[model samples]
Every structure is written in C-alpha cells, then in structure tokens.
Target: MTILITGSTGLVGSRLLQRLLEAGYDCRAMVRGGRPKPAGAHAVEGDLFDTESLARAVEGVTAIIHLAAVFRTGDEALIWKSNFDGARNLMAAASAHAPHARFILASTSNVYDKSQARPGCESDAVAPTQAYPASKVAAERALCESGLTWTVVRFPFVYGDGDGHLEELPAHLLSANWHPAMRMSTIHHRDIATAMVLALDGKFDGHVVNIADDVPASMLDLIALSRGEMTASARPLAEPWAMQVDTALARSLGFRPTIRTVFHAAEQQLL
Candidate 1:
C-alpha cells in the first residue's frame, strides 16, 4: 500500500518517512522549500495553501499522514490558515480523489482543558487557550466530521533526535507566566512515529487517541535540560494532575513506547 506524508522534511515527519520506507511500504513525500527527497520515496512538491498541489499530493495514495502544521508562529492568521484551512484543503482533495484513504492527523494534548484536576483523556473537554492548540482543535474537528476514514493522534511534547524545541523552555519560563511546578507530558519522536503507523493500521477509525510516555516530566527537569542549571519554584501546579495525560487507551491499542521517559533522552545525549 502506498502512503503520502505531508511535512516530510520536518523533524517528526522526516523520521516517520524513513521508518515507513524501512517497513517496506511505498511512500510519497510531499515536499517544499527544495528539500531533498528520501531515496526510496517519490517526492511531490506542494504547499498546503495550494489546492492544486494538495490534490497532486493525495493522488492514488492508500493513506495520508498529515504532520504539517504551524505551531510556533507569531502570526495568528498564519496559524489558522496553516492548521485549519490546510487540513480542510487536504480533506477536500482526499474526498474527491482518494475517498477511501486512511487519513491520520497529528494533533496535540495541549488541546485538552488545562484547568481540570486529572490527566487529559480522549473523552475530556477541550479548551485551547493559545493559537496553536486552538488551530489543532479546529483541524481535529474538521477531520472527524469529514466523510473519510480518519484517526486523530493527540501527542504531547515530542522531543529527541537533536530537536532543540525544549531548549527554549528556560527563556519561556523566565518571560512567560508559566508555573515552574507544572509538569509536562512528553513523548519521543520514535514513539510518535510508531503511533502514526499504528493509527494507520489499527482499528481506531473515527476515534481520537492519546500518545505519550509512561511518566510526566517536571518543569525543573525541563529547565535543567534546556539550561545547564536547575532551580525551584514555589508556585504549585494549577491543578495537581494538570498536564499529566492518560495513555491507557493508546497502550491498549498496542503502542508500547521504546523510550519510556525523558531520562532516556539524557542517556542518548539528546537533551
């Protein structure tokens, strides 16, 4: 079966593309910015904003792994356009061309309500406060309502593979009104890729799945990882269990993470 991967040049998508090829699946990589195509995969040059290119990207593919999104942009308009409108455009194309194709969307655990007293779950209410998470929520809703086989994999903070995304935590903590005692749910890039593959083949059609590591990382751990030193904060988490997501559903669906914790990241010197 052939699979089309959008954002194939990104951190998570790039790795997933390699893994999919290694698994002996025919792959089509939707690429832009003159990014070099994977050796064994066909490259379809496209932009999410370009409907024609999106149509070209989805032709004859049995599955579409959509990982392209705008998460760290300062422009609010760009965030909605890239996340919501992008998913809409792709779904429209897939509906017309590859109606029966499996569509797996990459969503975030941040879409969960942050004020709840317990860990986030698939059935929990969502209240996104920021543009990125809000856009993802909108995208998720669109895909769920679209007339196609779909699965939404909600990921927590994905790190590793030389990703410096967490490295900015030190500055963010200093500048933003973030609570130091707040814990973070995390998953390695390998695990996220595995989840995507699982979602592609698993019996989770028309459902949402949460993918995360076994344990939650404290803000102190993140600060120490980002910076060379660690410091304590007297402020406690808004709710004791906030940001700790429940992965029981994903685990039951046969997703066992090879890297169970951020400590593994330290072992590989990825932090």
Candidate 2:
C-alpha cells in the first residue's frame, strides 16, 4: 500500500518516514521546494497552499498522513493559513483524487481547557484559546465532516532524537511568564511514529486518539531537559497547574509507548 506523508522533513515526519520504510510500506514524501527527500520513498514536490501541488501529491496514495502545521508563531494569519487553510486544501484534494484513502491528522492536546483537573480525553469538548490549537480544531472538524475515513491523533510535547525541540524551552519561557510548577503531557518521537503507523487500521476511523506518556512532566522538568540539568527559579508566568491527557483510548487500539518518559530520552542521549 502506498502512503503519502506531508511534513516529511519535519521532526516527527522525518523519523516517521524512516520507520515506515523500514516496516516495508511503499512511501511517498510530499516535500516543499528543495527539501531533501527520504532515500527509499518516492518524492513529490508540493506546497500545502498550492492546489496544483496538493493535487499531484494526493494522487494514487492509499493513505495521507497530514502533519503539516504551523506552531510557535504569534502571527495569527500565517498560523490560520498554514494550519486551517492548508488542511482544507489537502482534504479537498484527497476527496477528489483518493476518496477511499485513510486520512490521519497530527493534532495537539492543547485544545483542551487549561483548568481541567484531570487528563484531557478524546470525548471532552475542545476550547482552544491560542491560534495554534484553534487552527487544529478547525482542521479536525474539516477532516471529520469531509465524508472520508479519518483519524485525529492529539500529541503532547513530543521530544527525543536530538530534535532540539526541548532546547527551545528557554526561548519559549522568555516570551511568556511561566511558573516552574506548570505540568504538561509528553511523548517520544519513536512512540509517535509507532502510533501513526498503527492508526492506519480501518477500525480506528473517525476516532480522536491522545498519544502521550504514562506520566505528565512539570515545567521544571522541561527546563532540566532543556539545560541537561535541574535548577530553581521563581517566575510569574508559571502556575502550579497541569494539563494531562488520557491515552487509554489509544492504548486500546494497540498503541504502546517505546520511550515512556523524557528521562529515558536523556539516558539514550536522544535529548
């Protein structure tokens, strides 16, 4: 079966492409511009905003893993165009070219309310305050209502494999005041790849799955991961709160995390 992957050069997508090839799936990497394609996969040049490019990319693929999104941006227009408009374009292409193709979207757990005391579940109502999460919510709605087989996998602070995603915490903290006690759910890149592939089964269609580790990580822990050590700090931006996600639904569908925590990542020097 052929699978087309968007954002194939990104942190999760790059590793996912390698994993898919190793598992013997015929893969197509949909790349923008001169980005180098994965060695074993077929290459298709495309931009999410370009309808012609999207049409070519969507043709004849058995499945389309939609991972292209904009995060960490203050520009609302760019965020909406990339995350929401891009998704609509791709979904439209899939509908026209490959109507029976399985569609998998990569989403974030930040769509949930920050004040929720328990972990966010798939059935809970989404309340996205930021432009990034709001765009994803719009994308999810489009995919679900598009009359296609689809799955939405919500990720929470994925880290590992020297991706330097964790290293950006210092800069993130600089822009917003965060308390050291703030906590968030997390997952490893390896596990994310695993979940994406497993989601291809027809049984998971129309489901929203949360992919995360068993335990949540604190802001201090993230800072430690960022600096490679722990330190004390008193910041007004952070609140003593947590936003955990329930992954039980995903686990029921045969999803198991290979890297259970960021500490394991540090041990393997992936951080």
Candidate 3:
C-alpha cells in the first residue's frame, strides 16, 4: 500500500514520515515550493492550493495522511486558506483520482469547546473562535460530508523525540495568559504513529478519535518541565476542562500509547 503524506517537513509530518519509512512502508511525500524531496520516499511535487498538483499527488496512493496545516501564526487568511480551502481541494482530488484511498486527517484537540465541562469527547460540539481550530473544524466537516473513507485524529499537546514543541509551551501559554492550574492532555510522537497505524488498519474508520496519553498535566508543571518560569497563581479556572480530552474511544478501538505520559518522556530523555 502506497501512502501519500503531506507536510512531510513539518513537526509531526516529518517525524511520522521517518518512522513509517524506517518500518519499510511504501511512501510518497507531497512536496511544494520546490522543496527537496525526502530520502527513501518518492516525492510528488505539488501544492495544496494547486488542484492539478493535488491530483498528481493523490493519483494512485492507497492512503493519504494529511498533516499539512497553518498554526501558530498571526495571519488569519493564510490559516483559513491552508487549513480549510486546501483540505477541501485535496479531498476533491482524492475523490476524483483516488476514490478508494483511506484519508486520514490530523486535527487538533484545540477544536474542542473552550468551556467544555468534561474531558473533550468525540461527541462534543466544538466552536473554536481561533482561526486555526475553527478552520480545522470546517475542514473536518467537509471531509466527513465528502464521499470518501476518512478518519480524523484529534491530537492533544504533541511532544517528544526532541520535537521542542513542549519546550516552547511556556512562552505560548504565558502570551495567551493560560491559568497556572489549567490542565491539558498530551501525546508522544511515537503514539501519533501508533494512532495513524491504527487508522490505516480501519480501526478508527468513519469516526473522530481523540488520541491522548493516560494523564493530563497542569500549565504550572509544564512550565517547570520546559524550564520556563511564570508567576504562580491559585485562582479558580473558568475553563478547567478546556484542553483535556477523553481517550476512552481510542482505547476501545485498540490504541495503547507506548509512552504513557509526558513524565515518561522526561524520564527517557525524549523531550
């Protein structure tokens, strides 16, 4: 089975591509802007904005792992175009050129409602005001409506394998003024591959699955773990469950994370 991966140079996508290639999977990378192709994988030169290129990328692959997205940017227009419009374009190309290919979308847990009273579940109605998550939600709905076999893996704070995502968390949360006590679910890079392999096997077919590790950590502890300092506070949190997620569905579908927690990553020096 040939798997086509978009965003092969991004944080999650690059790492995932490496893992899949190491395991000897037939892989193709959708490259754009004349970027160099990855080693040991076929590079299908394409752009998400260009449908013709997308068609070429989706031509005969058995599956499409779409990790391309715009996040952590101030540009709203770019975010919407890349996240929503681009996704629809790719879906259209897949439907027209590769109707039987499994389409796996990498969504974020940030799409969950900010005021969620419990761990964000697959059934929760999300209304993200931020452009990034809002655009992801739109893309997700469009793909579900499209006549294609699809699965959405909503990821939490993804870190591990020296990705530096966790290292930058303190500055981000500080800028957003996150509560010190606010807790969030997290997933290791290895576990993301685990979820994707499960999706490729039809374990999460036609569903939105939450992929997170066993425990949730607080912003205060996370800041310390990242070695960034912030003033401590004990104020009550208005959205205590904002970033926490329910992984029961993923577990039921047979996803057991090899790294159980961020603390485990710390212990293994995987941060």
Winning model by lDDT: 3
How accurate locally is residue 139 in candidate 3, as Cα lDDT from 0 to 100? 96
Ordered list by TM-score, greatest first: 3, 1, 2
- In candidate 2, the residue pairs with backbone N, CA or C atoms under 3 Å apart (3 or more residues apart, or in different chains) clash, namely 177-237, 178-237, 178-238, 179-237, 179-238
TM-score of each: 0.93, 0.91, 0.97
Off-target runs (Cα >4 Å) in candidate 2 are: 228-241
Q: Rate the local accuracy (lDDT) of all candidates.
A: 0.85, 0.85, 0.92
Error of 1 at 202 (Å): 2.7
User: Candidate 1 — worst ten consecutive residues by lDDT sum?
Assistant: 228-237
Q: Model 3: residues >4 Å from true position, as ranges?
A: none
Better of 2 and 3 by TM-score: 3
- lDDT tens readout by residue for model 2, 1-271: 8999998888889888998899899999999887887788999999988889989998999999988888867899999999999999999999998998999999999898877657789998986879999999999999999998999999998788778888888776756555677778898888888888788766467899999877778878888778844445665533233467888998898888887788877887776
TM-score of 2: 0.91
lDDT by residue (tens digit), candidate 3, 26-100? 999998966988888898899988988898899989999999999879999999999999999999999999999
- Model 1 agreement with the true structure over 64-131: per-residue lDDT tens digits: 99999987769999999999999999999999989999999998888877777689989987878799
> Per-prediction count of colliding residue pairs?
0, 5, 0
- By descending lDDT, how would the candidates be arranged? 3, 2, 1
lDDT of 1 at 82: 92
